[model samples]
Target chain A: MATKTLIEAIREAMDEELENDPRVFITGEDVGPRGGVFRATMGLIEKHGPERVVDSPLAELSIIAIGIGAAMADLRPICEIQFADFIHPAMNQIMNEAAKMYYRSNGTWTVPMTIRAPYGGGISGGLYHSQSLEALFAHCPGLKIVIPSTPYDAKGLLKSAIRDPNPVLFFEAKKGYRAIKGEVPDGDYTVPIGPVNVRRAGDDVTIYAYGMMAHYAVEAANMVAEQDGIAAEVVDVRTILPVDREGILESFKKTGKALIIYEDNLTMGYGAEVAAILSDEGFEYMDGPIRRLAGPDVPSVPYSHPVQEAFMPSPKKIADAIREIAEY
Target chain B: MADQSVDLQANAASEQARPSDSLSPEILLEMYWYMLLSRRLDERAWILHRQGRIPFHISGMGHEACQVAAAFAINRGVDYVHPYYRDLAMCLAVGMSAEEFMLGLFGKAEDPSSGGRQMPSHFSHRKLNILSMSSPVATQVPQAAGLAFGIKYRIAQQLQDPEDETQPRLALTSLGEGSTSQGEWHEGMNWAGVHKLPFICLVENNIYAISVPMHQQMAVPNVADRAAGYGVEGIVVDGNDILASYDAMVRARDRAYSGEGPTLVEAKTYRPVPHSSDDDDRSYRSRDEVEEWKRKDPIARFQQYLLDRGILDQNKIDEYEARAKQMVNQSQSYADEAPYPEIAPSLDPSSVYAPVDK
Candidate 1:
C-alpha cells in the first residue's frame, strides 16, 4: 500500500485510464499545459498529446455538451467543470442530454462520459467558488453521483466512473484534495461505484456522510468514542446515486439511531433523502429520531472567516450531533 | 444561343446535387419523392392530432426541400445529423422509415425514439446516426461540434489526413433562427471555429420561435451573419429551392472535409402553420402573411421545378402524390394498431442508468 494524497491519486487514475484506453480523453479549461486549476491533470497533455488532453474554452455549457457529443461519437470523454460552483451553466447538458441520452434513444445511444467538479466549502473560495452541488445533481435520476472522501476511493471510484457505460458525475472534495491522504495500492484495483464503506463500527448510532464530510464523520466518531465512550458507526457513503440501499438499510437497522451529515444546505439536502428512506421502509427499526447536521439554508457560503466557519460543518459540529443522537 | 447554353451549364454545375456531373433526371425525381413524402407525413400528423389520435404535431411544411437536400448532399449513414424537431424530411432522407416516424408521433410501444418517453417530433435513432434531440433548443449544437471534433481527433490520432476523400466525417446540426440567441449555440460555434472542427450548422429561419418573431430574437436580420463572429463561412439561400439548398450543403460539406473548418448555413424559409398543434398563428400573424409564405412553400416550389425541367408531368406528379398519401395512410394504420408503452419500465428506476444497479 502506497500513501497518496487525494489529488495525486486522482491524477494517477486519469493517467492510467488514458494510457489504457485510446478512447479516453480529457477536456476542460486550463486542463492542458496549465495541467488543471487544481493540478489534477498535470502532465497529462505531455504524456498523451494535445489531442487527448484538450484545453477547452471557458464555456461550461459547451464543455459538457461537447463531451456528450464526443461520447456519442464512440469516444469516452471526461469533461471537467473547473469547479462545482461553475457547473450550474452545464445543468442542461448534464441532466437533459447526457443523463437521458440512453433512455431518450430507447437504449440506442449511451453517453459514456464522466464530469468532474471540485465541490464543498473550504479554501475560503467565498460564495461563487466553494459550493456543494451534489444534492442538486443527485435528484437527477439518470445520473450517478460519486463523492470520494479518501485518496483510495478517489482513485478507484474515478477509474470506475470513467469506465461507466452511462453518464457519471464525480465530485471531488476541494477541502480534501491535499488534506485527505490514505494508503492506495499501485495497480489496477478499482472500488465498485455503488457501495458504502464502514470506516468504524459501533453500536449506538450510524453516522452517514460523503466527500469531505465523510472524513469529518470519521473524526467525530473517534472523538465521541474517546471522550464520551460512544461507539458510533461511521458509514462513508461513497456513491449516493443509486444509493447502496441494502447496505444503508442494514447499517441503519443495526444501529437504529441515524445521524446524517453533509456539507450542503440542510433543507431538502441529500441527507434528507436518507431520512426519507429510513422513514419510508426502515421505520420499524427506528430507535431515535433521524437527525441531520448540514449547512444552514444560507444563500451562499460567505467569504468572511467567521461566517464561512459557521456555514461549514466541522468535525466538532459533527461530533456534537453524534453525541446528541447517541444520547437520545 | 451558345452563350446562353454555357450559362445554363454553369448554373446546373453550381446548383445541382453532385455526382461529378449533374444529378440524373431520376435522382432529381427521387429527391422530390422524399419531399412529397415528408409533406404527406406532416399533413397526416396534423390530421391525427386534430382527430385526437395523437397528442400533438409539429409541421415541417416549408422545410422539406432544405432538410432533404442537406441530407442528400451528405453521406447520410456515415455522417451524424443532430436535427431539430422540424426535420421530418431530413429524418426520412437519412433512413428513418415512415412507420418509425408514425410510431414516434403516436408514442407507441415500438417507438424507437424513447419508447413513448418523449413528445412527438423529437427524433432519434442510433443505427442511422441521428442524435437524440432534447427539449432545450440549440443544446444539440455543441454536441454536434463535439462529435465532429471527436471524428477529427481520431483522424489526427491515426495520423491520417482529414482532407482525404472519406477518412473523417462531419456532423450536421439544424436549429431554428430563434435558437441562435442561446448561449450554448454561440459556445458551440465558437468551439467549432476555434478547433477548426469539421462541422456544419444549419439554421432554418422560419421567422418565429413559437410566437416570438425573428425581429425580437436577434438584432441581425440574417442568422448566417452571426457566423462572422466565429470566423466561419456563412451562406444564405432560398430554402424553398431544393437545388440551392443542396448546392450550399454540398459546398459546406466539401469545405469541412477539406479542413477549412465549420460553416453556418441560413436557409430562409417559413413556418406556414403554427409552431405546433398547441400554437395559434392567428393571434400574432395575419392570414395574408401566411398565405404569402405558403406560395413559397418548399414542396410546391420543388414540384414546379421538376415539372419545368420535364422531370415530372401531371401524371408523374399525381403518381408520386398518391404513393406518398398511401404510405402515410399505411403508416397511420400501423401506428393506430400499435399499443401504448408499458408504464412499468419507464417508472422502474433500475433502467434509468445503464449497466443496471450496482
Candidate 2:
C-alpha cells in the first residue's frame, strides 16, 4: 500500500487504466501537456504520449460529444471539465446523450465513458470553480455516479468507473485534492460502484454522507462519541447512482435513525433522494423521520469567513441532525 | 420523385456505360428499390403525422438518392455512421428494416432503435453501425469524424493481426446546408480532412432550414465550397437525381477508402413538405416554388425512366406499392401491440433500481 494524495491517486488511476486497456484514453482542455487545471493528469502526456492523452479545443460540447462517439466506438475515454461549474454548458451532451444513450436504445448502445469534474468548495475559488453538481447527474438514469472521499476510494472507484459498461460521472472534490491522503494499493484493484461503506461503526444514529460531506460526517461522529455520549455511525455512499441500498438499510437497522448530509442546495439535494429511499424501503426500521443537513439554497457562497462557513453543511449541523434523530 | 429523377438520369447514362465498371444493372436496380422504399416510408410518416397518429415527422423526400446510394457504397456493421435526424432514407438504404423504422416512429417497446425512449424519427440500430440520432443538429459531425478515426485505428490493429478481415474505412456523417453554420461541422471536417481520415461529409442541401432559407444560413453560396477551407475536395450533385447521388457517393467512398482524404458532396435538393408535422411551410415558402419542385419530382421521373426502359412493368409498380403499403401497415400494428416501458424499471441503477442482493 502506498500513501497518496487525492491528486496522485487520480493520476495513478489514469496511468494504470491507460496501461491496462488500449481502448482507454484521456481528453479535455489542458489535459495533455498542461496536466489538467488540477494537475490530476500530470505526467500522463509524457508517459502515454499525445494520442492517448489529447488536449482538445475549447469546445466543451465537442469534447463531450466526441468522447461519447469514441466510447460508442469501443474506446473508454476519460473526459475532464476544467471546473465542476463549467458542466452546465455541456448539460445537453450529458443529460440528453450520455445519460440516455443506453436505455434509449434498450441496451443496444452503452457509453462506457467517465467524465471527471473537480467539485465542492473551500479553496475560496468562488462560484464557477467550486460547485458540487453531482445531484444534477444523480437525477438522470443510464449514468453511474461515483464520488470518492479518500485516496483509496478515488483510485479504486475510478478504475471501476473506467471499466463499467455505462456512462459514469466521476466527481472529485477540489477541496480534497491535496488535503486528503490515504493508503492506496500499488497493484491493480477495483472498488465496486454500488455499495456504501460504514466509515465508523456506532448504534446511536446514522450519519449518511458522501464527497466532502463524508469527512464532516466522520468528524462529527468522533465529536459526538467524545462529548455527547452518542455513537454516530457514518455511512459514505461512494457511488451515488447505484447507491448501496443494503449498506444504508443495514446502518438504519442498527441505529434506527438517519441524518443525511450533502454540500449542495438544501432543497432537492442528494440527501432528499436518500431520504426518499429510506422512507420507501425502511420506514419501519427508522426510530425517527430522516432529516437532511444540506447547504443553504443561496446562489452566493459569500466572501466573509462567517457567511462562507454558514453556506455548507458543517460538523455542528451533522451533529445537531444526529442528536434530533437519536432523541426522537 | 427523387427516385424517378435518378432513373431518368441513369437512363441518360446507358449510352456512356463502360464494360469495365463493376456497378452492374442489377446493382443499380437494387439501389433504385432502396430509394423507393425510403421514399414510400417517408411519405407514410408524413401522412401519419398529418392524421395525428404520430406527433411529428421530418421527410427525407428530395434527398433520397444521395442517402441510398452512399449507404450501398459503404460497408455495413464494419463501418460507423453518425447520421442526422433527417437521414432516415440513408438508414434504410444502409440496412435498417422497414419494420424497425416504423416501430421507431410509433415509439414502442418493440422499436429496436430506441425502445420508446427517443422521439419519433430518431433512428438508432447498433447492428447497422448507425449511431443513435440526436435532435441537436450538427452534433453528429464531430462524432462521425472521431468514429471514423477510431475505425481507422482499429483497422491498423487488424492489419497487424494475421486473420483479421477489417478494411478500416468508416462511412462518416452528413448534415444539412444550414448545419454547416455550426462550429462542430467545421471542426469535424477540418480534423478529418487534415488527417486524411476515412470520413465523408454528405451535405443534404434542401434549400431551407425551417423559416430560414439557404441564403440566410451562409453567405458562401454553397456548403461544398466550404471544403476548400478544410483542406479537402468538394463535389456538387443534384440531390434529387438518384443516379447522380450514386455517382457522387461512390466517388466519395472510393476517395475515402483509397486514403485520399474526406470528400464534401453538396447534394442540392428541396423539401417537399413542412420541416415537421407542427410546421407550416406555406407561411414562409411560396406556392410557385413548391409547384415547380413538384414537377421535378424524383419518383415521377425515375418511374417514367423505368417504364421507358421496360425494366419495371406496370404490374411490378402496383406490386411494389402494395408491398410498401403492407409493410407500413404491419409495422404500425406491431408497435400498437407492443407494451410501454415500466416506470419502476426507469430508476437509477446505482441507487434505487438495482435488484436486491441474493
Candidate 3:
C-alpha cells in the first residue's frame, strides 16, 4: 500500500486499468499529453500510447456521447468533463443515452462507461465550477451514481466503474482530491458500487453523508463526541444511486436518530431522497424525525467566506443537527 | 488501396445485381415493405395510445426509406448502429423483433429494448449491435462515432497476420436533421473524419422538427454540405426515394469501411405524421407542402418503379402489404397481452445496478 492523495489514487486507478485491460481507455479534453486539468490521468498517455489516452474535442456532448458509442462497441471508456459545472452542455447525453442504454435496450447494449466530473464547492470555485449535481444523475434510473470521499475509495470505486457493465456517473469531489489521503493498495482492487461504509462507528445519532460532506460529518461526529457528549455514527454512502438502504437503516435503528448532511442545496437535494427513504422505510426504528443539514437553497455557491460558510453545510451545523436529534 | 478499389467494385456489382438493374428492382421492394410495416406499427401504437393501452407513441412515418435502406445494406451483428428515435424502419430492417418493438411501445416488462423503463419509440437490440435510442435527440451521434472506432479496434485485435484480410468495418450511426444543430454532431463528424474512423453520419432530414422547419433550424441549404467543412464526403439523397437512399447508404458504408473516413448523408424527406401522437403538424406546416411531399411518397415511388421494371408484379406487392398488415396486427395483439412492470420491482435497485463479475 502507498499513501496517496485522492487525485493520485484516481491517476493510479486509470494507469492500472489502462495496463490491465487493452480495451480500457481514457478520453477527454487535456487527458492526453496535458494529463487532465487535475492531472487525474497523469502519465497515462505516455505509458499506454495515444490510442488509449485520447484527447477529445472540446465538446461535452461529444466527449460523453462518443464515450457511450465506444462502450457499445465494447471499449471501456472513462470520460472526464473538465468540470462538473460545464456538464450542463452534455446533460442530455448523460441523462439520456449513457444512463438509459441498458434499460432502454432491455439489456441489449450495456454502456460500461464512466463519466468522471470534479464536483462540489469548498475552495471557492465560483458558480460554474462547483455544484453537487448528484441528485440530477440520481434521479435517472439506469445510471449508477458514485462519489468517494477518500483516495482509497476513489481508486477502487473508479476501477469497479470502469469494468462495470452499466453506465456510471463517477463524481469526484474536487476539494477532497488532495484534502483527503490514505494508503491505497498498489495491485488491482475494486470497491463495490453500492453499500454505506461505517466511517466512525457510534450509537447515538446516525449522520449520513457522502462526497465532501463525509469529511465534514466525521469532523462533526468527533466534535460532538468530545464536546456534546453525543456519539455520532457516520455512514459514508459511496454509491449514491443504489444507496445501501439496509446499512443506513441498520445504523438508524442502532442510533434511533438520523441526520443527513450534504453540500448541495437542501430543496430537492439528494439528502431529501435519503431523508424520505429513511422516514418511510425505517420510521418504526426512529426516535425522532430524521433531521437534514444541507447547503441552503441558493442559485450560486457564494464566494465570500461568511456567505459560503452559510451556503455549505459546516461541521458546526452538522454537529448542531446531531445534538438536536440526540436531545430529541 | 487495392482493397478499397475492390470494395467499390463490389458496391457497383451490388448496385447491378439483377437483370432489372435499378436499385428499386433489387432492394427497394424490401425497403418499402419495412417502411410500411414500421409506419403501420406506429399507426397501431398511436391508436393503442389513444385507447389508453400504451402511454406514449413517436411516429417515424415519412423518414422510412432512408432509414430502412441504411439498415438493410449494413452487415447485421458485425456492423454497429447508433440510431436516433426516428429510425423505426432502420430498427425493423436490422432485425428488431416486432414483439420487442411492441413491448417497448406498450412499455411492458417483456420489452427487450427498455423493459418498461423507457417510453415507446426508444428502441435498442443487442444482437444487432444497435445502441438503445434515447429521448434526447442528437446525443447518439457522438456515441456512434465511438462505437465505430471500437469496431475498428476490435477488428485490429483479430488481424493476427500482417497480410491477413483487411479489418472488418462497422457503420457508424444515424441522427435527425435538427440534431445537426447540436455541436456534438460537428465534433463527432470532425473527429471521425480526422481519425479516418469507420463511420457514416446518416442525417434523417424529415423537414420540420415539431413546428420548426429546416429553413428556421439551419442556415445551410443542406446538412450534408456541412460535412465538407470536416473533410468528409457529403451527399444530398432523396430520402423519399428508396432506390436513391439505398444507393447513397451503400456508398456511405463502403466509403466508411474502406478507410475513406466518413460520409454525411442528408436524406431530404417529410414527416407525414406529427412528431408524436401528441403533436399536431397541421398547426405548424402547410397543406401545400404536405401535398408536395406526398406526391414524392417513398413507398409508392419504389413500388411503381419495381412494377415498371417487371421485378414486382401487382400480386407480389399486394402480398407483401398483406403480410406487413398481418405482422402489425400480431404485434398489437402481443402488446395488448403483455403485462406492465410491477411497481414493487423498483424497490430492489439490484436489478438495475447488479455488479458485473470481473
Stretch of 10 with least lDDT, candidate 2 chain A: A299-308
Q: Write candidate 1's Cα lDDT for A134-234 as tens digits.
A: 88888888899999999999999999999998899999998889999999989787889998899889988999999999889989899999999999999
Residue runs of model 1 more than 4 Å from their true location after superposition: B1-21, B159-168, B356-358
What TM-score do all the candidates reach, one by one? 0.96, 0.88, 0.87
Q: Evaluated on chain B only, what are the TM-scores of all the candidate structures, in order?
A: 0.92, 0.88, 0.88
Summarize candidate 3's per-residue lDDT along B1-358 as a digit string, tens digits: 0000112342342456522244444465666678878877877878888988777888887788888878866675557777777778888888887777898887788876778877776766666666677676666777778877776665564422313333226655887788788787887887788767878989878767778877777787778768888888887777787766677787787777676778887777888777887888888877887787778777788778767878789799789879878988888788779888877864455555535886
The TM-score of candidate 2 is 0.88
Candidate 2 per-residue C-alpha lDDT over B282-324 given as tens digits, one digit per residue, 9 for 90 to 100: 9988998889888877667767777787777789888878887
Number of colliding residue pairs in model 2: 17
Tell me what fraction of the real C-alpha contacts between chains A and B each candidate also makes. Answer: 0.77, 0.41, 0.78
Fnat of candidate 1 is 0.77
Which model, 2 or 3, shows the larger lDDT? 3
Q: Which stretches of candidate 3 lie over 4 Å from their true place?
A: A227-229, A284-289, A314-328, B1-58, B97-111, B115-120, B156-168, B325-349
DockQ of each: 0.75, 0.32, 0.55
Q: What are the per-residue Cα lDDT tens digits for candidate 3 across A228-299? A: 789889999989986677877888878878898888878898878878878888888878878888877787
Clashing pairs in 1: none
